[model samples]
Target: MPNETLAGLTILVVEDVTSIRSLVVKLLERLGCEAVCEAADGETAWHHLKRRKFDAVLLDFELQSDDGVSIAWRIRGDDGLINKAVPIVLLTAHDEARIVEAASKAGVDDYLVKPVMPDRLGLRIRAAIDKRQDKLDRQARSTEVSWKA
Candidate 1:
């Protein structure tokens, strides 16, 4: 990967806890992201998504109003949203197989347990972005091929 690959990226962080959100934003800044927006709940995050675009979303598993799984599901299923394909990385305290499975089924691109290390978080973000980009490229190519036929 290129140096400071995340330098121009905009990220949305959805976490109900103020301290966690702040910590994540700080780390993202240090990791070279240009912008990091914070939302305390799923509804707020959805609103932000409608108003602006983000390169990725970091979502907390437990929120006061909406859980990360439901938020991720809504994002993936919502046909009207332009940011539907945005990569979602779920953060949670649980490391159980059930939690990870549920997150995967909800369309989360990545999962990280609590007390996330900066290095691991950076790696996860890079992986998720690359994965999303690859999927978009494949879809675009398929569409082009279909149109040519």
Candidate 2:
């Protein structure tokens, strides 16, 4: 990841596997993100997400308790969330077509398979954030228009 892309951003990494979670955190540190919050399970992730605002979220597709797609759906639907339109990266070993389709429907900004490629992780994260920003900007513009669609 580019150092400037993620500098000073607060990121949330949600993974059930300890080793994978640690690896993700190390990568985030390498990206120069000083504030990284971690959640080992789906429920814990939900609490953290509701209580704080994150610039981006890196979440496992399948959790021990809560699933990533479901969580993403909730986040997208929840108006009260700290950042309801935040970018989401769905990380998992399952890269089936159905899973990818589900992720898209759930509002995932990016999708990466496990044994996640280190070379693309940063780029994907940056891309997801950029995409989310674009979506938010469009929404803001639409709201400012005089005519309603």
Candidate 3:
């Protein structure tokens, strides 16, 4: 059965390896995502990011042309992106502490080590989205308070 929270979300899956990318896409579909976009590299992923708004991003830590941290940084920093504050779940084979720290610093909302299990993937994605939403909510509240002050 599909998860209710993820049922209607549009997601972007970025991975260099064909098989892994396919697996991730299938998993997202199984979770009932409304739309699943694919990108084999950071460039393509950036193109998708700029052109479309995704509920969440599943980004590979190591890509042939670019790294997930850099892409995450770009997403967080780029004002031109349709979804600059979109939730990002970094998928990586590396479980190193330094890498995790870097990803956190880059503004990734969650991190998952490969091979990703369906249950865990769903949890991570949902968590990331919730985290982003919480931040947005807090920011909005702050802005409103300041405006009324």
Leading candidate by lDDT? 3
Assess every candidate by TM-score. Answer: 0.91, 0.92, 0.94
Pairs clashing in candidate 2? none
Per-residue lDDT of 1-149 in model 1, one digit per residue for the tens? 33474788899999999999999998898888999999999989999999898999999999998899999999999888988999989999998999899999988999999898888988999899999899889989888743454
Native-referenced Cα lDDT, model 1: 0.91
Which parts of model 1 are misplaced by more than 4 Å? 1-5, 144-149
Model 3 clashing residue pairs (backbone): none
Residue 119 of model 1 has an lDDT of 87
**Residue 14 deviation, candidate 3, in Å?**
0.5
Per residue, candidate 3 scores C-alpha lDDT tens digits across 6-62 of 799999999999999999999889888999999999989988988899999999999
Q: What is the lDDT of residue 97 in candidate 1?
A: 96
Model 3 ranges off by over 4 Å:
1-5, 146-149
* lDDT ranking of the models: 3, 1, 2
lDDT of 2 by residue, 29-140 (tens): 7777869999998788889998999989998998988889999999999888886888999998988999999999999999999887665888899899999999989989
Model 1, C-alpha of 26: deviation from truth (Å): 0.4
Is 2 or 3 the stronger prediction by TM-score?
3
